[model samples]
Target: MSDLYIGLMSGTSLDGVDGVLVDFSSVQPRVLSHATQGFDDRFRAELLQLNTSGPDELHRAALAANELARVYALVVKRLLETTGTQPAQVRAVGAHGQTVRHRPQQFDGTGYTLQLNQPGLLAELCGMDVVADFRSRDVAAGGQGAPLVPPFHQALFGQLPGVTAVLNIGGISNLSLLNASGAGSLIGFDCGPGNALMDAWSQTHTRQAFDAEGRWAAAGTVHAGLLQSLLSEPFLALPAPKSTGRDLFNGPWLQAHLQSFAHVSAQDVQATLTELTAQACADSLLKQAPDCKRLIVCGGGALNTHLMSRLRALLPGCDVASSAVHGLPPLQVEATAFAWLARQCLERQTGSVQSVTGARGARILGAIYPA
Candidate 1:
């Protein structure tokens, strides 16, 4: 056979879930079908609320996870229908639940990360073996339990010459420095905020979900002082093996920084947020992988024209482009990676990179929920 797998991802942005049906029969995996489902305003707000503490959180999270599983199941249905594939045909469905809080290696030494998901529900709904919770294993092993796409990037794009880096700009931004020359040949870490901050800012001002194509940000001017203030975040200066989410860079974090820049216009603040994401990614690459030549940008941020332009301006020497040019579209990259991860789990192979997540060693990530 044919090695068919389905991958589902609802990332930090909290915007929606992306699912992909991929065939990995040959050496090169191909996306046979793709589907997406966006969370309504109310549901999105609830998910964001669960990011912090609230009344009956345990109960609320469970219900939310069930609802999320339903959404994933819907996407799975679409993918299978589009490709005329059966549940039994797919080896497994890799589901990355919504990450509400990510604070690995914090309190009590071995900190925890949470990705709310009902793998069993998903398995039952989709009638396929489901692989979920692909992070806790790494955290338990003294790793960050994040930025899990580096190894996938290496496997997919390692053929490129020179020091190639893949920048995945989701709700949070991360870098995967692949095929390096000397020590630290493969490095990956959470750089900084991606569209999460910008999306929040836009919603606050314009009541829009996100700044489409970054037009709102492009129309405004970057406030140098605010940009510098955002850059001063200590997390950005930290070494690799670090990951972050709404736990640190959430609304409170942005509001705290804006307390001093109260007079700043909303549009200017939006511009500054965009620049912050671009700067953080650029700074990380410069510091960690200075020799990086080709930078493949993926995730939702790849579609932001203004952000992409800023990255190009910030990193003059490096060639920046979306993963689409490399045959994988922006949204499909992560989903495909999860499909690959599902294959890894089924084969009893290592799915995470020790160097990337700072895990003790390579581990077969994810828990399988059999149908």
Candidate 2:
């Protein structure tokens, strides 16, 4: 059998879908091809709306999921076509599906984390087996059900001589701590908000999808008062094995914080928000992995030069750089990780780490839809 797989990821930012065709026959999986398809403004808005409660949300959620599957299928087609590979030659497609709600260990004590995806539909559309719902199993095992990329991070960067960290700043920020020892020393968790707040603020004030290299924030001044208010969010102080999404850091939450600072300029708020993200991430590293010597950043936020600079400034002890310098580009890291996870599922191997998610034990994740 061929060791080819496809990985699709559309994160909390709702930016778009990223797909990768990977060949895993070798020790280091090689990314055969990569493709991205951005969501139209209308679709992006709908996905964002679906994050909160609304009338007939059950029906709306179902339709949105189907649409997401279609989008995933389109990306899969592009990956296969770009690589000139046949679907039958691929083992499986790991679809992370857009996370609409993520509140683990809440309410019922076994709180569910919902991701919008119709994997069976994706399997049918692409003629490939699909592996998805990767978080639920971990949650059921009494875990945070997030920061699933750590094991993959260990696979890619664990051999370094000291404590190394991988920070993926999507809509939410997550950190993977890898010590030189091995998997026994790995730990990972969601740090806090990443691009979600800044993206929302930019769309509201500047009518742009994002700050574009965080230029809007770069042009503004950071407001000390507003920065303090934003940092006071309780999630930022939560202990490890914690994960969060739009549920805690949405527009309403920001608006509530802003009610106390009506005089703050829009640009200053943008700068302050950028600082909030940088500070949250830096604080997490300093607190949890103070020995970390290198921080390899990945995901959409990695493209924000201003955010990158803020991180570098905050963590004066560490050498911060993009994941591109470490072999994979920022955008490709998560997708490639999912590809690796799918392979683990097929092999009946454990994917989640016990130390990272606080699960009872490591478990093979994801549900497979055979082709």
- For each candidate in turn, the TM-score is 0.98, 0.98
**Tens digit of per-residue lDDT, candidate 2, span 164-186:** 99999999999999973454489
Q: Each prediction's Cα lDDT score?
A: 0.92, 0.93
lDDT of model 2 at position 108: 90
Question: Per-residue lDDT of 192-292 in model 1, one digit per residue for the tens?
Answer: 89899999989999999999999999999999998899999999999888889989999999999999999999999999999999999999999987878
**lDDT score for candidate 2 against the true structure:** 0.93
Error in Å for residue 93 of model 1: 0.2
- Flag regions of model 2 displaced more than 4 Å: 180-183
Give stretches of model 1 more than 4 Å off: 182-184
* C-alpha RMSD for every candidate: 1.1, 1.1
